[model samples]
Target chain A: MVKRGAASCLLALALPAGAAEFNAALMVAPEVDTPNTASPYYVGPPLVPDRASRQDLELRLREGGFNVQETLRWQTIRDRTPEQHGIANQFYYDGELGDGLGWTAGKKLMSWGVGFGFKPLDVVQRENRRLVNRPALVGAPVLAVERFTADEAWTVAWTHPGRGEGSDDFRDASLALRWYRLSAGGDDLHAVARLSHRRGLEAGVGATRVIGEEWSIYGAALYERRTRRLMNMLVGNGGTLAAADPMSEQVGGGGTKAVAGAQWTGASGWSTLAEAWYDADAYSRAQWQRLDALTASQHALAGIAPAAAIAGNVAWSSQAYLTPNLLRENLLLRLGYDDRDGFRPYAELLATPRDGGRVWTIGAAFEGNRQRLALGLRQAGGADGSAYARAPIRRAAWAEWRLALF
Target chain B: MSRRLAALALAVALPASAAENVAALLKQADAFRLPAESVRVETQVELYKNGALDKERLYTVYVKPGRRSLVLMKSPSEIGQKVLMLADQFWLLMPESQRPLRITASQKLLGEASTGDIASMTWSEDYDGVVEDEVDCPVPPPNLPEATAPPKPRRCLHLDLAQARSGVTYARIELYLEKSIKLPIKADLYVGSGKRAKEAWYVPKPIEGQQRIMAMLLLDDIQPNRRTVVHYRSIVPKAAPDEFFNPAALVRNSLSGW
Candidate 1:
């Protein structure tokens, strides 16, 4: 039914009598990995297996005062069971409503905040953890209205039936508003407020300024109230399932997240970015030590049948509670060189300062007239009780080929 | 003295006085480089490294002197990128970004060419010129299809230009202007330490419905074997809407393929 709906929307966009354009691409990627432990936790087969392929199609149309855009993707993974999925990535219609007002409605990807890697105000979409090099966010259905002048803009949006993990039903939707300003010295300032039926109120502020010819700095901070709190699940005496004990619960206490970053670009096409992220709700150093000890005990009990269930529960709890930048303090660094013609090489490092754990990714891409080829390698390193010590895959290598079609 | 001899000497002195004023020569050259009113043009640039094609890009530009100018990238990797210049300020917009980013004019755009080099052409407004010399120079012929003869040496005015603005990329430049048309023929750019950084050649091309003018520019790096050629394909004289220069329009017309 979802596929049929997407097809209908595509047809509707195509039927308009106006100038339309279409673009498409096909990509095939293959990878190999080495697990950190012999018995690794599996999450229903990896989304990207040893080999995977994807096809994407995009269409755009402009008629009168309205603009329409649509993108569709089909992906398949070559695993033991072979999995496939089709997605309507983005479809939106934007038009002016007179009186300096404009509106957009449909499914679309929206991004907020000023951080390069970690965004505190980007609440609509869940971050893709597997691929840290590129952002892969799912679009949500929304209606947005905006008004603009020379130096200021005001926007209000309503999102219904959010598609990601923590979203609830259509009845429990979200509303957001933002005010953006550009100062005389070319500085940007933004203030945003949001209300979710299930999650209470949230507010955020972001700013960006250019320090000199080669440097730019940006930061963002967000506070949320009445949010869901993640906790460790407790097992019963006989290893029986306890319905009363849940992994997460709603709490009245509020939490805050902040991120700051800077970027520098040189005259020779070399650029670097550095960012630091902080999560107030993250586990402290002592709490993380306690969790690590509990995990060790659970691993030792995996042999006993009755205790095996409880061990699985423990593993699930650890996965649920561990979030990106969960070590309270984290840093990200990215370095890249682009000749702008075809060749580009980049490297990224994500480090947990408190636990001394880090993940490094390095890649290079060469682009031709109609094709692109890329090769990448990723490695994770940490101490015994560090954040990445229990990572499923310690090292991995991958290659991808993409061909453009019009 | 004879009356005829005195008149002849006066005529010679009049021409010499006109050539001595380098400021007038610069003002004339600037008039030939920029259009009097707003104009839109399509441009293609090719960069060569070691005599081999290294990169190429296409752009659609709208220019209104003393007001604002907008350049929209149309080809290669960054398809929907744009650059807006308003007086001393510059902003950049990427396809996926929501706000325009502030940028510096000295940033490199391609081989040997800075963003300011491609965006602004009225050199007279940014530099103060001093008369250096007047000598015979070998000038390339106008960029017309029928011209095939090798360039013969002609009398040209040589002038030294000092930057008048703080954020300009080059501190000093030596320029050569053709005596007949008062058009720039060649230039040598100098950096902070007074070292020659690059050389530029202005080639004249005939506009379809306008006066003959130099419409193509070539910049060559002094150290590396690199060169960039910019060709003004077409120019249409018309004023663009005010919104076209607004940064907010970058997001509102994100899908318009501007």
Candidate 2:
């Protein structure tokens, strides 16, 4: 139905003389990398010892007409590791009417998914490396694109994971609305409300008010009524079987949780965040009686565990321009400490993809009229006495270069 | 020493008469402002790229006050490409399907023919002076070769052609006025863009009982970086209907026949 409607609109526009414009680009990249020797992220099983590496060819095309634009991209790597050899293609179709009503439909990554908002798309950052867990349904048209005059915009979108065979087809979608406002030369209120299909519901609200031109004070609170099934899906079934379903056993039972955090931005290019969370999953009469001092306050920053856990984290990112066109450098560093004392397997699995322990990265990008080059190094390791006590640290580095053709 | 002082005073006083006369003439010319009502002109635009002729288009220009003017293509047997120049904006009505697309001021006007800025007709406001022909003289050198006979004596005057200066007329221009008639017979225009200067001849003829200059040409030999020659094949003043200059009128007349 949508395709037919779009076709008729194009026909109407073509009744008169039509103008066509085209733009195209081609790219070739060759890379070589070592094999992974540590335990894979999914399970504590032996990792794939060695994998072959190779390069690929990519092409992009854009066709613009009176009021429509169509873009298509193709990428294929013939000789890659067993896990990496897959064709990655994306098609984007967008049209803008004279009245400002525009539509976009294609196979692009949906950036509004759970735990996906703050992170770049997997293809862009190559976070997971493996391509089996990619989102389905390609891309769908859901809303109209328009310019906003307000200081901030809160966008919420929903998705469904489709149906399954044994399990009730994972029916889930997440709606998150975040407003990042700018005031007094600094960031202001940045509130996020996320409601997912699996998790009963959750709300996180944050507010930041500028105290000076270069400094701001901010606070955020999170409340959640996590569904029991959702926890089971994450922790997997715990058993002695060598190959049992990893998502069957859930530790934290269904319960209510309240977390509060405070962070200061513009702290000399460094931000310090402190948060405390309490879960009433293992409820006891005495736990409610000692709510005031035990469930909240500055003790969270002193490395004291709330009923669940409290953590203090510091993160910093800075960029330096070496020259106008010859060189540029970027650095990212994060360090955090959590108070608790058990090797929580579930936490090790979910927390890192979320809190993502300690990470440091250094990258440089260089470009000229003829050639371009970029190199990045990353090291992510966490020492969680409370979880994954023996998890090995992981590190990786990559570099890419391209030549321009006119 | 007193004799030298008297000579200096006479030299300084010589320009006083010319300045006063030029200022008075400007006052009189104010009433002769190009009628802001409407104009129908036959024009040709020659496009040049890298100092070579690329393409040329003959057009019929219909202009109106405070509204859009339409320039319809008439040459190369191409589709009727219409360009509309409104008061505050400009647009192109593509004849392919009569789509009205807003054009940027920096785009080439007609297939690289001229810069869009020159088509907006705002160039005339950049100059400020008025000089009249106070004497009859032959056409200047370097324009008409010495081997060619001087057509007739014309009244010529030295005018300040500086741009935007208090008494300047054109950025760079020189006028050779007809001795008896005050109309300009020839003009030399030195464009600021890095190109050779251009000279145009305005040969007048009586048409429909009104005196009009119908012949015009741009000489590109001076500046090899740009080249173009335009000839007015036909012109009909006040021939365009009143509705042709409207923005909506252009859209309405676009897909439909004239």
Model 1: which residue pairs collide? none
Which candidate leads the pack in TM-score? Answer: 1
lDDT of 2 by residue, A1-406 (tens): 3354344334433544333322222233333223223412211112222222233322222234122222222222334323222222334444443222233343323331111112111111112211211121223222223211223333333333232111221234344344333333423344445455444455555544333222223344444546222111211222111122222313242444333333332211223334333333322323212221221232333444332122111000000001111001111222222111110110111122222334344444454333445555444444432112212224435544544332
| Backbone clashes, candidate 2 | 15
Count of clashes in candidate 1: 0
Per-model TM-score of chain A alone? 0.84, 0.45
The candidate maximizing DockQ is 1
- Please give the TM-score for the first chain of candidate 1: 0.84
Q: Where does candidate 1 chain A have its weakest 10-residue lDDT segment?
A: A39-48
Candidate 2, residue B30: how far the Cα is off, in Å: 29
Q: In model 2, where do residues sit more than 4 Å from their true spots?
A: A1-56, A61-103, A107-147, A150-196, A200-238, A249-360, A380-393, A403-406, B1-258
Model 1: how far is A27 from its true place, Å? 3.6
Model 2 chain B weakest 10-residue run by lDDT: B26-35
Alpha-carbon local distance difference test for all models? 0.63, 0.35
**Candidate 2 overall lDDT versus native:** 0.35
Question: What's the DockQ for every one of the candidates?
Answer: 0.21, 0.02
